[model samples]
Target: MNFQINKDVLLNNLIVAQKALSNKTPNPALQGIKIEVFKDHLVIITSNSDIAIKLNVKDSSLDVKEEGSALIPGKYFIEIIRKLDALKCNLSIVADNMLRIEADRSDITLNMMDLEDYPELEFSEKIKSVKVNVRTLKTIIRQTAFATSSIENRPILTGVNFKIDANKLTAIATDSYRLSQKEIELQDTYEPMDIIIPGRSLEELTKILENNNEVVELHFDNSKILFKYGNIKFQSRLLEGNYPETSRLIPTELPIRIKFNKDSLATAIERASLLSSRDGNNAIVKLSVRPDNVIEITSNSPEIGKVLEEVYPVDQIVGSPIKIAFSSKYMMDALKIFNSTEITVNFTGEIRPFIIKGEYDPEMLQLILPVRTE
Candidate 1:
């Protein structure tokens, strides 16, 4: 393949593709990126069986002298681009299917794999497309992805469950102890789509998004999901199995309602967790509300002593004073996604799950299972 591409575009695409290329794979082709130079565009693809990425740079961004394709080792090829100092780069196919990458005064020829040997990714353009604002997508991932179970043994729990119906779109993730669910209305009509997207894939997608205002395109078939944005396309294998029905798990009402400054509560919990780690278990934060809207947060460890943190509430509690203990780590995770000044923490009882939601934002809710303390 002989083509001249803008250095910045080529490098950016290469960098993103490199993230999906894993060297530990038994299949050698999995470690390489397939570069196909068509009549008017250059396509770069890489996959590790679970996730695949494709980047297309049109002829408008490149000056093509010839057309061909090759599979080159993703790591070394990316290194070549990184070391090159030029505004544009040239890639050529010579004898023996060898590939040459040239930039400025430095050029390197690397052996290429046969294009036919590379695995084919069947993308489904026919599947119903679910469009979401990039900002909302990012927010959903941030608020929930962190709670996804990291253990590979339970693959289903390692993904964020996405449910789309005619009216609302909900994304939920949980590690059993805590769960986060975010819901938003769909502005346009779309067929119902229920699927589990792996947390790792969503994390990568979140990082790769350039702007929040851009609309992200989501396409799903029975087995895979394709996320298309700008010049990049990301495909992730869908996790199989019916995601547990979580709607019934969320409480309908809470007897105790406490609203506190989001920043102040987050800071207090962070400071308390530092000293309360007596064992490997995270620190426990206890919350109680007084009649005058004074909410107190306390943390205690047998060896590390105890701390008392007090903050004023936006609203007063009408029910009996409720005492509840929760993992400081879990509370902090839920607080990070709340950008609002005041956040509501609702509780039914000491042992029941508590929920965090914004004053005006009912579309998002974070639930944390309380820790039993003697």
Candidate 2:
């Protein structure tokens, strides 16, 4: 392909596209970025089979000398564009599957892959779309994606479940030990959808969607989903199999509820976990709630001694006093997503899973299972 484009613009899009380029792909074409030069715009596509990203650059932003297409190696092509000191770069296809890049005083020639070898990824524009605020979507991803299971034993648990029913959209993720759920009210409602999106894909999608005010259009089928925002289109393959029903896992009534400062609780857990280790019991911490409105957090480690801290002046405590032990890491992960000043911890029993929620925000909930410490 032959085209003249600005160095900075090309470099930025290449960096985003490189997220989908896999170095270990058995297919050589999957390791490169497909550049398609059109009469009015240029399309850059990169995919590793699991995730694909396409960036469209309009001719108004570049000097399009000719219309052609080429599949250039992603790593080398991006590196050349980033290091070039010129304002504009000229790319032309040479003889015998060779590509030449000329910018300022730098000139580089690289072998290109066959365009026919790339996978066919065509997105339909006529499909139904869901419109969501960019900022809200990003928040949902940040709060829930971290809770997804890192292990692939249960592939479905490695994705964030998106459930759209009526006018509400809920996002939930869990690793069995801990869970995160966030809900948002939708302005317009359509057909209900329940889909499991891979957590790794959402993490990469967040990076490309930096603009908070812009809305994102979502299009999905039975096996794949597409996200269109601004000049970028991102698609990811959906995991097969039904996600476990998690709504029933949440307790309808938590008898023992304690309200405490969010920051204070998080700080106490962080300090108490220092002596605890992940080797055996996974840095266990004990929370003792007393009738006198005092909460004690303590951790004991044979190798590193012990730590004890008291969190007093709790806002309120209902039902009977309780003591629970849980993984310090899991508690901290659940606490980090809250932006509220005060948080409430609801406990059904010492052995039962407890729920954590912001004092004033009802849209987010985090659940943690207690560990048995004798």
Candidate 3:
């Protein structure tokens, strides 16, 4: 294909498309990015089988000398584009399957792969779609994606479950040991959707998206899901199997309630975790509630000394006095996801699962299983 595109615009699209290129694949063509020059737009596509990306460069932003297509190595193409200094770069395809790229002072020739071998992203005419704000989608995933299971034995647990109905959209991620759930209302009513998206895919998508107020179109078929935002299109395979039902784990009645500053609780747990090791993965922080509504956090290690941290709460509690031991890592993660200044920690009982919620709303909640230190 022959086209003259702005160096910066080409470079940016290459950077995003490269995320799907796989170097270790058995198929050599998979290591390259497919560049298609159409009548009015240039399309760049890359796929590692599991995840695929397609980026478009409009004709208004570039000068077209000829219309064609080629598959060139993604790594070399990106590096060369970044090094070019000219406002626009000319890409021309020549005889003997050679691709020529020229800019202000640089001219590079690369052996092009057969364009026919490059896999094309499959899209269905009929699709179920939903609208989500780009900013809200990023934040919701960031808050819960961290809790997804990293283990390989249970592959389904490694993804975040997305359930969308006429009124609400909920995203839930858990590692069995801890869970995080974020729910928000939809702007308009639509069809119901239930799907599980891999955390890794969401993580990569979050990185490429800019911090702006834009809406992303979510389209799903039987096997794959597509996320189209701006000039980019991303598609990923859905994980199989039903996600575990978490509603039963959350208690309806919170007998013991305590509201504390999010930053203070996070800081105390971080310090207490310093004494904890990988094997134990445990930090026993004892909490004692006095008659005057004062709470003390104390942790002790046999090899090291003990630490006691005290933080005053803005709201007082009237529940029975209690002491609980839990994973310091889970506590820190749950606390970090709380965007509000104050977070409420509720306990059903010392041995039962405890819940953490944002002070202002119950839409976002975290559940942690207390460990028996004795």
lDDT of 1 by residue, 1-374 (tens): 69998888888888888867878998888888988888888888889867888888774668888887888878888888887889898889988888888888877898887777788876556556888888888878988899999889888999999998886899999888889988888779777889999999899888888665888889888789999888888899999998988878889977777778899989988877776744346777787765666778887777868888887776665567888888988899888877788998888888999888896567888899998878
Clash-forming residue pairs, model 2: none
lDDT of 2 by residue, 249-356 (tens): 899999888888888898999999998756465788899976677999998878879989999746768888889999988888888888888888999999999999
| TM-score, cand. 3 | 0.93
lDDT of 1 at 286: 80
The positional error of residue 78 in candidate 1, measured at the CA in angstroms, is: 1.0
TM-score, every prediction: 0.93, 0.96, 0.93
Q: Poorest 10 consecutive residues of model 1 by lDDT?
A: 274-283
**TM-score of structure candidate 1:** 0.93
- Among all candidates shown, the one with the greatest TM-score: 2
Q: Order the candidates by lDDT, highest first — what do you get?
A: 2, 1, 3
What is the C-alpha local distance difference test score of each model? 0.84, 0.88, 0.83
In angstroms, how far off is 307's CA in candidate 2?
A: 0.3
